[model samples]
Target: MPVNPPPAPTLSGDLLTIHRLLQSPAQIQRRLRTIQDMRFIADQVLTQRYRSAGGAVLYEVSEPIFNTRPIEAVSPGSEYPKDVTAEGAAALAAVSKWGQATRLTDERIKRNARPGNELDRVLRKVVNTVIKHIDTITMSAVASAVTATQAAGDDWVASTATILRDIELAVADIEDLQMGYRPDTIVMSNTKYAYLASDEKIANLRQRETRDNPVYGGEVEVIGGLVVVKAPLSVLPSDDVWILDSMQLGGMADEAEVDPGYTVAEMAVQVQSERLARQDGWEVWGRRITVPVIQEPAAGIKITGTNPA
Candidate 1:
């Protein structure tokens, strides 16, 4: 029996199979872009260019008054009303660069059975890191833009009456600003969304829509005419829900031609695999350039204490 030991098991076949699972170059790039697109806050706001002449600082212009006077029928000789005075101001916003990089050793690349696109994985990591940083910055800006906050009590599900009232109040506050803006989007943490989806009141309302309709499946409820969405806890606090006029939020990015520009659309991952004299690995890195600004704070409201027990 000792002399009958079989030959050692070969791993080449398994390795080859695993190599086949590596995605093509196009697939890799598409996946990365898809991930970035999924960032809800980034997709919702307005994005503008930061021109090179703007320098490292950009200004947000504001006009406090648009002087509107009621029109009156003028007598034939009455002097036409004078044009209203124009008052304008700007707030300075400093732009900063954010970047992440990763290196893959030559040996590791050679050992990879799927070798042609070895650097794709490294670039993906860099892209993901940059997107996360952008999201964090945008979320922080949103939190700061909150002009009003309401307490939703311990449970929105149990306190349905209060919840509706609070939502209405939040919407009313935005309307009271008279800024020609309305709250059209409601964002909340995933935990809060789950609770709301399961609440008896919400379920009953959606029952008609979900009846025997595959396309209208799940809870399709709108509160106070605002479309509700679930966001990660990192973006919105688990204990709060935010109602915002998304149009009022502005984001800026620099173009590629701009010096020290930081714009997500212009963001790219650079790869260096050849001409390495000492290093034996491929270097991959990406940068994110952005300035998240609250163009109108009065357009957004945050509701707190909504966490379910």
Candidate 2:
């Protein structure tokens, strides 16, 4: 916490011009630091992440595809065991940079009757845009990183008989391939999740299994051995449901160095302000250097057409 925070510039009397805000590098940096401390679904779904800039995303194509192997009985004199190599070949995917920058004009700043409040709003939205963009990349990676698709035999929204079965089928779809990954998580839209909560069977189970049901408690717990992630419509703008082993789903590659006590995503952003070379105002720039990659596609399965038609 800052002892004496930067004063909010007023339109009149203590007029705070855009130049004043830009001049305070410490204040601008402090604000960005706090903003960088934020988190999103990309942070959760992409469980593997670290700080590193260059080089390709080296990963296993299929990974350990053999779920079970034959064991041989051996005498004291017999050989110990056979050696086995990991399934799939080594592949490389270049990490691409993703960033966005917004310029602040003095004319625009002057129009803002409440410069202090509006400036804060501007900075928040600017950084959030970049973060959301990163989240979208990861969502797209996982959504497309599936070779198996489980179409609901019955509409999940209306039919109760196959709701749980649908999830298991998606899980098995991945496990049956012997890909050495078991899905323990499911991601869906809030609308679809509401239907799951309203299911009579699920409601009864919640009622009998625990006195403090998630239904009445206003929270969702584990269901059918899978952690439920009801994502926002904007984040998951699809009718398709995803069940995956997040531990093996994908990872993020960061180009910026993370400072101690700060997240890689936070440190990935660099914010600075400089006088407009030709203009009368300052130009505030925000950039994030990071990328998300799906290392193993077989670790996930997509369940399509789960929403009501």
Candidate 3:
């Protein structure tokens, strides 16, 4: 059986819900996995391109294909030999060997010659080093997740933009969502006859076709809205940049309300600018990083329709 048609409002609303749902932890984890897989795929793509270049200068000047990072062992539970400590009976146990006991040459040899304090220092260093390595590994894991998160955010924005443009053409009507459609995608239309007095008809004659004119049959009221797109990028460590949030996707609303009677081409142009705004926003961010500035403002792009001729 074919899928049931979703009500018009449900189309945009459902997509928005899904987009918000993606920001949840479960979705975030899924995105992380996706990023790792894509990283591998991106590397493969670059490698293929490099090979296809066939001794071209393109591959030679390219920086490293990908950054290399060591995978460190991270374990909160590590077994340290309790008997290895140099104290009391444990110290005596450590001194014993299978070989013949050495003969005492001097009176000092018969006594306790090994300093307990010296042994404590060695044990402390060993514990400290293990703790340090554990911290290092934890940081690396977090950094990897951050990198993956940024990648996922960029992928989502770009992917969503592509899907929206493709799907926009297929959308028949959008306003039915907020007015007639309820929580369910069910569209309830009142086809019952209604008695309208002559006075009431004249009163509503002009009002009926405000923007959403001709309720019975008319040109679909397609409200134009601004399109939002985001891209992920990194600031050079030398720049000492800080992102309060690990990943950010920011753009204007999908449908920007305009004066209802504008030409469709004006709306289309606005949409196109919003699409380009994604690239512009990234460039603005890049420039902010390079220029010496005390603080960087949040970056975004706003697109508006031009007045119709």
Candidate 4:
């Protein structure tokens, strides 16, 4: 036996209510969890937890400077030399709950503001809006912390330019630090990605495969052994490219997220609803509390001027 479809909005505001999925906190919580798992540059970084919402977010990095860090030679012996002294260090930054909220008032339904499908669309849109805001903040943090940067000699769009050469330089910069990081991810804006995907030289290098082939399929999934990710212009400038060891880019820290309840404790958008008794409506609220972090600046390289201004 099927349950009857939930009632739609009515002129009698007292009997009208938001669709069940939008009004129930638990249902919205599950929806948020599934959607948050999608790949965003923010999801590529590290993950951490703080005891509280406000205070300094603490992180540790090896004292060896990110660039030009040297590895000491070890001599073959019965016992290895004692560990180097004072190699550990910690840094701190202020972190607080970062979030945004919007209300769904009842007057709109009475005014026939949205069709039933349109009302559901808004429920979905609010979820993305909250998560997208967080993604931008995290990407910005990583961009600012990047100290390893170089300029592409020519815009990747130029037929004579070589993207492989730039990738090699990016990989070399991080490896030279002698930290065991192997850059595995490359990110750029769609416009820059189009240039890379269209380059004949790159296609020639990977034409052996049919799937995701630049020529055979006009799709580019990876280039030069780096997983390619295209980002919005707001997160990545069209002229910039980022190559990084995702495991070392640092991660988010927001203990408040788990405090309310979450077993795995990852940064997930929190959604809740409240009824305005007199107003005859429900206001859906979406928020997340976290901050992105950077532990090894050398683990990532920002290649600038990848395209013409």
lDDT of 3 by residue, 193-213 (tens): 111111233224345445544
Superior by lDDT: candidate 2 or candidate 4: 2
How much does candidate 1 score in TM-score? Answer: 0.71
Per-residue CA lDDT of model 2 for 119-203, tens digit only, reads 6666776667766777777787777676678988678767544777788888887888765787878888888787777777677
Q: By descending TM-score, how would the candidates be arranged? A: 4, 2, 1, 3
For model 1, what is the alpha-carbon lDDT of residue 74?
Answer: 80
Give a tens-digit lDDT track for model 1, residues 100-132: 767766666567665434555665667767766
TM-score of each: 0.71, 0.75, 0.15, 0.77
lDDT of residue 259 for candidate 4: 41
- Could you say which candidate leads in lDDT? 2
Whole-model lDDT per candidate: 0.59, 0.68, 0.21, 0.66
Highest TM-score scorer: 4
The clash count of every prediction, one per candidate, is 1, 0, 3, 2
| Candidate 1 lDDT score at position 12 | 66
- Which residue runs does candidate 4 get wrong by more than 4 Å? 1-19, 33-39, 46-55, 63-80, 106-120, 208-211, 214-218, 256-267
| Per-candidate RMSD, Å | 7.8, 5.3, 35.1, 5.1
Residue 52 of model 1 has an lDDT of: 29
For model 4, the local distance difference test gives 0.66
Cα-based RMSD of candidate 2: 5.3
Compare candidates 3 and 4 on lDDT and give the better one.
4
Ranking the candidates on lDDT from highest down gives 2, 4, 1, 3
